[model samples]
Structures are given as C-alpha cells and as structure tokens.
Target chain A: MSAVTAHGVIAPILVPLLTGTLLVLLRGSATPLRRTLSMLGVQLLLGVSLWLLLQVADGEILVYRLGNWAAPHGIVLVADRLAAGMVLLTSVLALFAMMHAIQGSDRRGRQFHVLFQFLLMGLNGAFLTGDLFNLFVFFEILLIASYGLLLHGGGAARSRAGLHYVVINLVGSSLFLFAVGTLYGVLGTLNMADLSQRVAALGPEDIGLVRAAALLLFLVFALKAALAPLHLWLPGAYSAAGPAAVALFAIMTKVGAYSILRVYSLIFGADAGPLAGLVDPWMLVLGLITLVVGTLGALASQRLALLVSHLVVVSAGSILTAFGLGGEAALSAGLYYTFQSTLVVAALFMLTENVARTRGAFGDELRAGPMLPAANLLGGLFLVLALAVAGLPPLSGFIGKVLILKASVGAPAAMPWIMAIVLITGLLTLIALARAGSTLFFKTETHARTASLPNVAKLVPVAALAGISLLFVVFASPIHGYAQAAAAQLVDPGGYLEAVLGAGATDNDADADTDTEPAKMAEVAGPRRTTVHSPPDQIMPAH
Target chain B: MEALIALVIGLLAGCGIYLLLRARTFPVVLGITLLSYAVNLFLFVMGRLSIGVPAIIEPGRSAYADPLPQALVLTAIVIGFGMTAFVVVLALRARADLGNDHVDGREP
Candidate 1:
C-alpha cells in the first residue's frame, strides 16, 4: 500500500532489465565474475517476483504509472495476482535457464546473462503493461534479446533457425502494430482500461467497419498466439532454435496468451469482438485443434527439442480452448495451466539439451543409440513432464483439464465441437508423448567413449522447470484459487480499471491528459455491464 | 463503392496467395508484401472513406472522416515495412548460408 509497493510492482520488469544492460556493458570481464553477475541477476528477479506474488495475494492490485502519469496518455504497468503469478513463474524458470546457459558455455557468461535478463524483462513487461502500444514495445524488447540468445552457439543449424525465428517474429510484431493502430482508430484511445470504457459504447451503429477491424485485430493476435491455422510458424521456429533458447522461448507464447487474456476480458469486454459468442468458444475449439496438430507434430518429429517444445504449443492452445468453454473456473484452469505448462516444457527442453549435448556432433538431429533401459533421473523427469503434457491423472495438468471439461461440457454457450476436440486432443497428446519417449530417450547411446560434454550446469534450467511442475501439483489449490480470483476480476473489470486508472474518471478527454482519468476511472467494464445507448442503423455515415 | 473496394482487396489477396504458394522464398516474401498492402488499404477503406474531408479537423471545421481507422492503417503500414525488411534479410541469409532460397528445411 506504500510507495515501496508501487516500486515493487515496477521492479519486476526493471530489475532484470537493468541487470541485463549492466551485464552487457561489462561483457568479457573475468569469467568467474561474469558468471557470478549472471547468477546474481536471475536471483534478483526471482526475489522481486516472490515479493510481487505475495503483494497480489494480499488482495491488492498494483498499478504503476510510468513517471506518475495517468493512463491513456502515458504507459501503465499493472500487477494483479495473475500477472504477478506469471512473473513469479517466469522469473524462476529464467533463473534456471540463465544458470544453464552460463555454466554450459565455454565462453564468457556475461553476454548470455544480458540476453536472458532482457528476455525476462520482455516477458515481465508484456505481462505487466496495461497499454496496447507498450505490449508491442515489450515484444520488441523480448525479440531483440531473443535474436542474440538464439544465435548463441553461432553455427549452421542455429544460424539457419535463427533467421527464420527473427523473420517470423518480426512479421508477428508488424501484425501487432497494425492491429493496435486499427483499434486505436476506432476507439480513439490506446490505454486498455480506457479503451474498455470507450469500446463498450462502440458498435456497428457508430462504427460499421468494426466488424472487419475486430476480425483483423483478432487475426493479428491469433497469429501471435499460434492459433491452429496460424500456428505453422511455431514448430519450425521453436524446433530450429537451440535447447536453452527453445526452453526460454517455450514460455514466449504465453505473452500472446496473456494479451488474449487482457484483450478478451478488457477491450472486447466479455461479450463483444467480431467473433461474439463464437469468439471464446471458437478459441476453445482452436485450442483443441492446435493441441492435436502440435502434439502430432511432436510425435512425428525426429528432433528431441522440437518434439518437446511442440508440446508447449499444444498446451498453449489448450489454455485458450479452456477459455472458450467460458465459466469462471474453466477460465481459471486455463490460466493455471499456462503457468504449469511453462514449467513442464522448460524441464523437457532442459532434458533435451542434456541428451543432445552429450551426443554432440550428432546432436543436430534427434537420433538414438543401440542400448537403453536406464538414466532414471533425467528420463524420469522427462516421463513425468510428458505425462503432464498429455493431461494424465493426479497431476496439475489434469486438474486444469478436468475443471475446464466439467465447467464447459453440456454448456450451451460453447460449441459442442470444441469440447469434443479437447477430449480427442487429450488422447492424441498421450500417444504423441509416448511415441517420442519411446523413440528418443529410451534408446541407448551410440558411442561408448564419446568423451564428456562441457559443463554440468546445462541440466539446471529444465530441472528447474520439472521441479516447478511438481510444485504446481503440490500447490494446485492455492494457484487455482488465485487464477479464479484473477479471472473473476477479469470478468468484472471495474475494480481492475479503477485500481489502475482511478474511479469515476471516464468523461474526460483521456488522450489530452495523463494524471487524471487513469487514477479516477481505474476500474472498467463492470461485470455484465452494458451501456444502453440507442442502437444506430449504420452509425457510420456513408462516403 | 464498398463492393468495389472489397473486390480490389479480394483480387490482391488472391494474387498474393498464389505467389505465396510458390516454391521460392523471394516470391513468397513478395506475395506477403502485396497482401499486406491490400489488407492495409482495405482496413483504411473500412472506416467508410469520405472523399470530401480529411480526418484531422481544425477549429469550426465540419464533420471529418473517422480518425481511428486512419491511425490504425498508418501504424499497420510502418509495421508492414518492418516485416518486409525482416523477410528480405532472412531470405538473403537463407540463400547465402544454406545455398538454397527455398523455405524447406535441410534434412540431416
């Protein structure tokens, strides 16, 4: 509640950011010192994330206006329990990945640390920002750092994949910019909370072209989210990137999901957008379809990292699909599963790195040796994660699915086809993981005297990811409860808007001023709130 | 008027898609650019274009064109530029390093 709390909220994005910048500035110093600084940055972000999570649990939403300006005019950063939870999760995994990247490398560790920090900064910033424009800015921050991290090994394979990765993301970012501009043209505002306020008052009567605009905007997001038909770029991009990079990027899709979460709940309000009743429902269906396609890709692929990372894509689709189902609990499960899958995929990526690095020279493709039936620790972690990915029983993943299924099934609001796909995809996912495990990890080493691979630190990140999944299972209820509250607040956006913008401040010209409207109309789109403005017949006048 | 604009967009989209389906990376990139332009113009026209008035208004000026779509289209144009550059660089890199300009992955 103090100024310190606001500082805390903003620090999650800034801590790693400053750390990354500092590390980059100090690159090529003493190796031990560089390693220490890299570890320090990760540890620092983890601490900040923990504090932010606790603040959210106290039932307080933190909104930090950059330079103390108001919403609409100035960029706003927010941390509800939901945003904080993601920050906490991302920070933990990032720390592990940073450690793995540093320890695994034979070169100086500082540059790696810098990229990792900036990447984390992007993730945190994307989650925390309340402005649509700022989201694009954060996407750039993440991608710029990602470009460096992706090409870390600097070889034929990484370089080729790196080109594709940069291109795909640049294209995605362009789509994002276009969508934002279009939406801004319609709404006359860019702040998400304020946009929600204005958007409620907009319809085809006032803006006949909204239908097309909305669809286009959603298409932009869909591409970023890798929704089914738009997901063709993901497997190649994730697969081509190296393991540590892939593991970090595994959670990158969550930025897209979080934007969906923000937009669906805020600007579009729960009931609006081009897709209408079909939006969330169709998203759910798309999620299931993506799940099937991604898992099948995993099963069919020969590479270890590619197979595991595709599961990350499937799980992302599943999260969106759950949202499509439309109950409070179902949506909450979707949120929780996003955090859970981030961990599971991270673990799987780490394990892939270990196996690949050990089999180096031959690591370009995911080939196997002649013998098998051992390496319990690494293999067991992989099995558990694979099971988690498939939504098997007693795990947190299954809990998310069960909650979604129970909430969605027989619900007339959602398309029946979507529910069916979720069920079918669940089955297919299991088959996919089983085939992958049987093919790659179960086989023995081809060469007995391949010589020891460099650095044991490579194991830490994936292990951290797997460890977090186990923690997710153990702490399912609390996490689920937080997601539920976050979803509830999402459903009733008034409180959130007020917390960020302020109460009763919607009448002012928000674009002209920074300090007034946001603090006053902090909360927006009260639950099932409808502005009963008289509907117009093509409110948009003809040319 | 709306139908005409839509038709133009549809035609551009069709041509873009046809080019996109080609085997070469450069053609696909070109197709993407053409499609982006068509889409941008379509979005611009979607604000229900008014020939007589610009969106920006001065004091005491009469009603203007809807301002929102214009802003959106402008941003989209800049972003499209960014995408085109990225694709161009990627295509060049693919050709230089891999010795092939096709989008297909090299088999191990």
Candidate 2:
C-alpha cells in the first residue's frame, strides 16, 4: 500500500480536531472568517471521507495503530467498508448542516462552529476506532457536544429536554463502562479485532458473564438508537434542538445502529458458538415495537418539528428492523434506508424551521396560521420532504422500504410481522405528514400574506437535501450496490481480523491458554494474554 | 476483598438508580454522579486487585497487574467529571429558566 493509503485512516479524526481547536482559539475573530473556516473544515472532511471510502471500496480493511502499538495492546482505527461509508455519510450530513447554520443560526449561540467541529471529530472517531473503550470515549465526546448544541438557543423547553438528554446519556455512559469492564475482565483485551477472537475462545464458565456484558452494551446502544421502551428521550430532545443541530443529530442515532451492527456482528457473530446471534431476536421485537410507537407518536404530534422527530424514530425502527433480520441482503437494505432517511429527515427539520420562520408567532405549530409569504416555494419543498419521509412512491423512502420488505423474506417467522408493522408504520407516517402539510400550508387564517418571506439562502440547504433524496431514487442501484458490498464485508469479518491483527492471529497461543484455564477463570484471564505476549515475537506483526 | 468491593458497588448503584428515578433535576444529577463513582470503582476492580505490583513492564517482573483498566478508569473519571460539571450547570440553568427544578419543568 502507498503511504497515503496506509496513513489516511487518521485524517478524518485529525482534520476536525485541528479545525475545532482553531475555531476555539480564534473565537474573537470575525464571524465571517470563522464561518468560512468551519465550512472549509466540513467540506474538507467530506472530501477526505469520500477518498477513504474509495480506498476501501474493494474491501481492504486499513488499520492505523496509535503510537505504533500493535493490536490487542494499543488503540487502532480500522477503516473498512462500513466505517468509511458511515464517516462519509456523516461528512455529507455535516456539510449541509454547516450550510444551514452559517445562514444565521450560528449567530444565536456561542461557539457553534467549535462545537460543530468537535461533534464531527467525535463521530468520525467513533466510526473509525477499533478499540471498544475508545468507542466509549468518543461516545462521550459526541454526547457532550450534542448537549451544547441541543441547548444552543437556550430556552425553557430546550433546558428541559437538555436535562433529560444529558442525564440519560450520562447513565448510558456509566452502563457502557460497566460493560467494557466486564468484557475486559473476562477476555483480556479491548481491541475489537482481538475481542472477536477471544470471545469465541471463551470457556463455558465465562459465557454467562460475557453474555450479560454484551447485552448491557446492547441496551446502551439501543438507548442511543432510540429503540422502544428506551426511546422516550428522543422526540423531546430532538425537537428541542436548534435547527442545524437537529439536522446533524440525525446521524447520531445511526451511530447507535452502527455500534449494534459492529459489536454484535463482529464479536458475538455466528462464529461465536455459545453467543452467536444473541441480539437478533431482541433487535427484531424491539425494532417493531419502536416502529409502532414512533408512528403513533408522529400521528399525535401537534407541531411540525415534533412530527419530524417522531419520523426520525420511525426511520430508526425501520433501519434496525432491517438489521435485526440478520443477513447480507437485510443489512444492505438497512444501510440504504439509513442513507436516504438521514438526508430526508434532516431536510424535514430544516423545512420545519423555514415554515416556522414564515409563520411568525405560530412557529411550527400544526394549527392554522396566517398565509405564508413564500407559500409556493416553501409548500413545494415541504411536499417533497413529506413524501420522502412517508415512504410514498417515486421517492427514496419508498425504494428503501421496498428493499427492506424484499429482504425480510429470508426470515420466515418474522417476515409477516415485519411486513405488517413496516407497511402499517409507512401508512401512519403518510397520514401524519398529510395532516401536517395541509394544516401548515392550506389551512391559512386568511388569504392576505402577512408573514415575511424566508431568505432564499436558507432554503438552499433544504432544497439541496430534498433534491438529493430525488437523486437517491435515480442512483439507487449503485448506492445499494455499495451497501451490499459493505454488508458482505461486515458479515464475514475475517478480513477485519487479519488487517488489524496479523494474518492467522486468531490461532495464537492465547487460545490454547484459555482452554486449559477454565477452572480458575478469573485468575487465569488477567495474565494469560500477557504471558502469551511476553515473547515479543508473538505480540507485534512483522510489518 | 472481592465481596467487599462488590457490596459497595451494589449499594452505590442501588442508591444512584433510586435517585435517578426522582422527579427533580438536582437529584437526577446526583444520581448520575453516584452511578459514575460506582462504575469507576467497578472498572478499577475489573483489572484484578493486586497490591504493590508494577502496573508497567519492568526487568525481571513476572507478575504485573492489568494496567489497562486503570487507564480506562482514569479516562472515565475525567469524562465523568466533565459531564457532571456540565450537567450541574445545566440543572441550575434549567431551574432558573423554567422557574422550577422539576425535570419536566413544571410542578407535578
């Protein structure tokens, strides 16, 4: 591999870190300068991520070791198809979010550009890191930035929502540490590639503890993904966020889904004899319940932003339901749905803000309001976004939902329920969006247009997002092809293992050590890996 | 020693969870703080309790305590500290802005 390809794995994390620090240092500088710098940073991030995606397009997993430390001993950032694609998705979403924030939302808050860059850094770090503990650190980074962004405008409602968001995530972080501890206690490594090998070799004595740890980790990710029973904080927290912040927050939930796909499929995969497919049944049931609850919530919402937030939950449900089906095709379908839904939901958040801007005192409420000045432009934008969100024909949402439904045929028993809930949720979303549209656009108080026209500059991002959704429909084949490749890479993580550790590393001496020490599980677990690595030749690869 | 550590962790977690379920923001923040303390201790113990052992590699050392969990706990402590500070400030702000301390921003 060329030097750039070898070292490019760290660029996505470094670029945003440097840019965020620069923005913070230059806080007293001109807003225009800061805005320009932030935009350049996000645009550069998008470029770097796209380049990384292309590098890994042929299914090469690139591992960047921090401090030249080898796997199982030091932190590494691995970029495979899934990680690269998710980072690219975040970069694309961040660019549009920056476009919207620069239009004026940044002026309403302190350090908007700084916080935005850190959020990107956190997201990229989370996607790329190969260490499970590093994943927890990145989760904290993103959550802290999100807390600041969510309360950027600072209101009673936002404060209320921010409290719940902060506290719940704090608890989640605690749970995450507990899980990490248990896993490390039982298996002697935090590196995911290493853990995948060790988890499979775990003795029967360690199975129950590892199972609990894995499930606890799942619960935390589910809370982040806004799956049911644990999804109570999403609508309130999302709706209360500032427009640009909410737009970026769309990918944050996908981070949870990404973790679920990564950890569950990699470590607790079909190869792990006792713990194989541990989360599959739970993922499906909770996913369907989340769909039902979210769709009903969307229908009951009295405000446009709340409705959009509920739609986000609906998308999460759909994507996870696809993932829960557990196969290459289902995962591919879920990935495609994730892409389109993120873009469309982000556009919906911005559109709600635009509508609220045009309606003066009746900000985003679904009740009848004064005639909007740019009714035609705004209404048309809302129509396309609503259609895409509701999974109607000729839009990307329809294509995604259809792909998921087609993939569900693999699981015979869950297929019917999946079909029923997914279709019913789509129908309910349609009804909700229809009601929100007419109430905002048609049910005007009077024909006399009183509210001022929204800035065309602000509408550009919304229009771009909607236009991309349309483009998604046009380019579904190639994009879905990429998703399929990524899914295939994910299901068979042997490449990931080989790239991070050396070739044939899973058959290392530690596997034999663990097998003989089953009786003294606790005492043996701590020093076994260390003993295996005492001879330097066995630890580091001959790179 | 293991039993004592486990008991402490269980007690702290039980109390933290109970406080977290309360309606007030202050108690909720306190609950999170207590829970984090419990988690940090729990993580510290996961490395296997060893006394007077080197945490790093050295000449002629055959036994060393697992140092990664200490490193992990240290990182967790710093993050938990930052989050607690932020949440505390946020709780005060929520109280000031909402004219109440209830998590839902209203007297129930």
Candidate 3:
C-alpha cells in the first residue's frame, strides 16, 4: 500500500473536515485566544504532516475509512506520497500565511484568525482526502471560509470580487458534482481504488461514456486551476481579494493541479484504454497552450497583483503539460516545477502587496514606473522571483523547466512544434518579466512614492522564501530525490493498487503474493449490494 | 439520449454564458442560475442516462444505476442552493452597497 496507514491518511483530512463547525462556534470571543488556537491548530496539522511524510518516506501507502465501512460501501481516505506531499506543502504555506495574518495594522475581520484557521483546516483536508465526494465537501469548506475571509474586512472592492470568486467556485463545485455523479452512474462505484479497478471493465461500446465523464471532471478542475481559455475569472478575482487571500491562493490553485495529477495518473490510469487517442494528446497540447497564454496574460497585466495571479495560471499550466505527457523524467520535472512555482508565486504576491502599499492604491490599475526609489530589497526579491518564474538559469524554476524540455524533446506523440511553442513561450515569459521588472523597479519615477510601513511578520516569510529561491542550486540533490521518489510512487500504481485490494494489516501479505498489478486489478467492484441507499437528504458520497 | 440532454444543456449554458458576459447584475445572476441547472443536467447525462431504475440495490437484481452519482448530486443540489442564496444575497448587498446594480462593480 502507500507509505502509511488509513489512520494516518484520515488524520490530515478528518481533523480539518469537522473543525470548521467548532471554529465558527468559537468565533469573536477574544482575539488573543482565537489567534493562539488557530496557530496551534495549524502547527498541529504541520506536525501530523511531518509525521506522515516521515512514515511514508520509505514508500508506505495508507488507506482509511471514516466509519467502519470499506470501499463501495463506505467512504475511503487514500494517501499516496503525492497526496501527502501536497498536504505538507499546503499546510506550510497556510501556517506561514496565518502567522502573517495576526500582525495587525490593516483592519482584518473581527474574528479573522478563526475564519483563517477553518480555511486552513479545509485546505489541508482537501489535499489529503482519497474520495471524490469528500474532495468537493472539503472544497466547499475551504470556499465558504474563503468567502468570510475575502469579504471579512468588507470593502466595496473585496465584496464585489468575493461575489465573482464565490459564484465562480460554486459553479466549479457544481461541475465537480455533475462529473462525479456521472462517473458513479457508469462505473457503479465511488471508491477511487474500486473505480481504478472496475472502470477498465466497461466494454468498448461504453467508451463514449468514459470520455464524457473524464472531460466533465477535467473541465471543473481546469476552471479551478485556471487553465487558459477557461481562466477568465481569476485575475480580477484574485487581485482584489486582499493580500492574505492572494498569497494563500497560490498554493490552493495547485490543489486542482494535484487533483488532476492524482486522478489521471493513478485512478484514471486504470481506464486509459478508452482515453488512449483522445485525452492524453490533447492534454499535452492544451497544457502547452495554457502555459503560453498564461505567461502572455501575466506580461499583459499592468497591475502587480494581477500579474502574480496570472503567473499562477502560467505555472499551473506548466504542471498540467508535464502531468499530461507521461515520460518518467517529465513527470518528475513537472512535480518539481509545481512545487517551485507555488512557492515562487506566493513570494511574488507577497511582494506585490508591499509594492502596492508603497505606491498607494491604484486609481485604475498598477502603472509601470519607478514608483519607489532605493527599494533595493523589494526590487531584488521581485526580480529573483521574476527570473525564476521565466525559467532563467541557475534557479530551481530553470532547472525544472529544463528537465521538462529535456523530457519532451524525444517524445514523438507530441509534435516538434509543440516543444517549439513551449520554448517560444518560455522566451516570451522572460521578455515579459524583464519589461515588468524594469517598469516597476528599475525605471525612474516622475511621481514621488509613499513610504511603506514596516511589518516584520510579512517581511520575514517573504525574505525566507527569497532565500529559499536562491538556494535552489545548492539544494538540488535532496529536492530531486524527493521529487524522484514522489514521481516513482505516482507512476508505479502498485503501492496504491495493492492497498485497496489487500486485506487488513494482519493479511497484508496475502495481497503482496499476487503481485501482478493488471491481472489482480481487473475485477468488477460494483457498488455494495445493499437494498437501501442512504435516503436522499442524508446521502453523502464516499469521498 | 445522453447526447440530446447534453445538447439541450449546452444550448442553455451558452445562453447563460451570454447573459454572464453582460454589464447588468440582474441578468448575470439569472444567467448563473440557468447555467447551474444546465451543468447539473449535463453532468447527470454523463452517467449514461438510465431511466427510472433506482440506484440503490435490490434483492435478485444485478442492474441498477450508480448510487455515487446520486449522492454527489444530492450534495451538489445543497451546495447549489447555498450558492444561489449567497449570490442573491450578494446581489442585494451589491445593490445596497453600490448606488446601482451593475455586473461590473465600477460605474466608470
């Protein structure tokens, strides 16, 4: 199975899944206590993740159920390295951001820490859950908390943006429901492992059903990930949502990417027979185009916040391309890039907030000019992240991109022209970042900029992230090893496949004996043959 | 049968998107509501559209619709209700917060 137990697997998701109710009930009592409890919760989550990562580092997979029911009959929580890694990453970003939240100068929500904590709980849970239904539930939990936080300070701009953000995600959630619902209808199973085994058995005549379901699911995720063409709502929505929201969102968007990575590579890989000609090739093409369009959008954006948001789109698209094209090296590279891009974009957005404060609120949009003089620290951090984003040399972003390019070079399934497009896109990205950097930091200003007030909470994390970016070259080996292990775990479906079919801890050896993955997984895992379904109002999927 | 439902839903979804592209708040809300329904229907059709068979299992019957989708739809319906309520309330707030109810928050 995966590197850990279902007990460990369910811990990350369950702790946060139900924590929101308590957080809401406890809201607005005392600022100090709320802040302390929230931070404690986040740190405790981090500790759980650290333990999970440590336990699973040697390649153990864990599966857990909410109640006592097994797959098809009950909800399952699956934790592979990839899913666990995301949990760790998301927890790190959210914890740091929450710390930044408690440093007060601006008017945050009255119970900002409470809402923020619930939001983190939701986020961590979403990343770790093994089931599709609960994925959506956690998604709502996160989104609902986001709603309160986004409109927490209650500004005209934030409220307006929150409306768009809330509505759009709601649309996304609806789409997710629709896709999952349809998949269940066709497969008769909701457990991901069960589906992975059974979905392949749906005969050739039913291929059309598979394609439609895959597309629906992909679309919902794409909208969340802000893959190009479908990414219409992101820039304005993210830019106006407040500093904490935008920074935290950089990692959140990757959950969509992570979902695609988990679903397609692991669960959907079982059913790739029908998807052979259609999904894979287009995914590569779409990914490349998304990368290009996203970078171009970032370049086109005049405002700093919007540019950072669009950059998230660009990086997500990069991960999408890498994940879709299944080369050993490419997948590893993509995972590295995904991690790098999330961290970089977060740092960049934090810088954007600082830049905005110094320049005053944009009357229309962020203008290109040397708004602040001698802003060397700010400029250097901005430039480093920009170059890293553009895939410049000696940086982690560049290394990751090079690995992706090297992986794509020989694969003939994609056109030589597709690689050309990605390359051209990379070059264009460098040019765009250069121009924006010059405009914002390097160029001379006609208008005198307002001085920025110091906030150690914000500055420490931003500086720490920049320092991490600088150490990309030095830290290459360890990072690569982690990425490699994570990728290998992903590509080889054995750990996960065995986990579901294998009996309890006592009989785990019974499964290992029948090591033939394909032959062992070919069974039909139809729904639990029960006469009664949980009645309409009480029904919940086994996410 | 699935294609027909998907097609009808697509048409309505297109209309909703058209309305969403407008500058007025009320039309955008209407569009979102309609589009949501279309999405729900389209997703249901993706399950291959079995007619009148209960997804729940029965004794001595091998054929049944998928219950997972039904469960998901139930949640979606509730979440959708929450969404509509949020949007409608936001609309009212937007009306109250801003002098006019324009889809674009800014008048200029």
What TM-score, computed on C-alpha atoms, does each candidate reach?
0.81, 0.97, 0.84
Chain A TM-score of each candidate structure, as shown? 0.87, 0.96, 0.87
Superposed Cα deviation of residue A446, candidate 2 (Å)? 2.5
State each model's TM-score restricted to chain B: 0.88, 0.96, 0.88
How much lDDT does each candidate structure score? 0.69, 0.90, 0.69
Q: Which ten residues in a row have the lowest lDDT in candidate 2 chain A?
A: A519-528
Winner by DockQ between candidate 2 and candidate 1: 2
For A229-261, candidate 1 gives per-residue lDDT tens digits of 888777766765656666788778887787777
Which is the winner by lDDT between candidate 1 and candidate 2? 2
Candidate 1 CAPRI level: incorrect
**Cα lDDT tens digits for candidate 2, B1-108:** 989999999999999999999999888988998999999999998878787777666677655677777888999999999999999999999999999999999998
Question: Interface root mean square deviation of every model, in Å?
Answer: 9.2, 3.4, 4.9
Question: In candidate 2, what are the lDDT values of residues A330-404, reduced to their tens digit?
Answer: 999999999999999999998889889888888999998998878899999999998998889899999999999
lDDT of 3 by residue, A1-543 (tens): 443444676676555544545566776566676666666777777888877887777777776766756544677676667777777877777666766666652246565665666677677777767677778888887888777777766768776777778767776776677677666655555666656655544555556776787788888888877777878777877787667666788877787877777777766673345664345666677788788888778778877777777888788888888877775677788888887778778878777776666655442144554356446767777778888887888777888788787778758757476578767878887877777677766564566555555454676777777677767667877776777888897776767766654534213333322331322122213333221122333334322
User: Can you give the lDDT of residue A115 in candidate 3?
Assistant: 63
The per-residue C-alpha lDDT of model 3 at residue A241 equals 68
Count of steric clashes across candidates, in order: 23, 0, 11
RMSD of each: 7.2, 2.2, 5.9
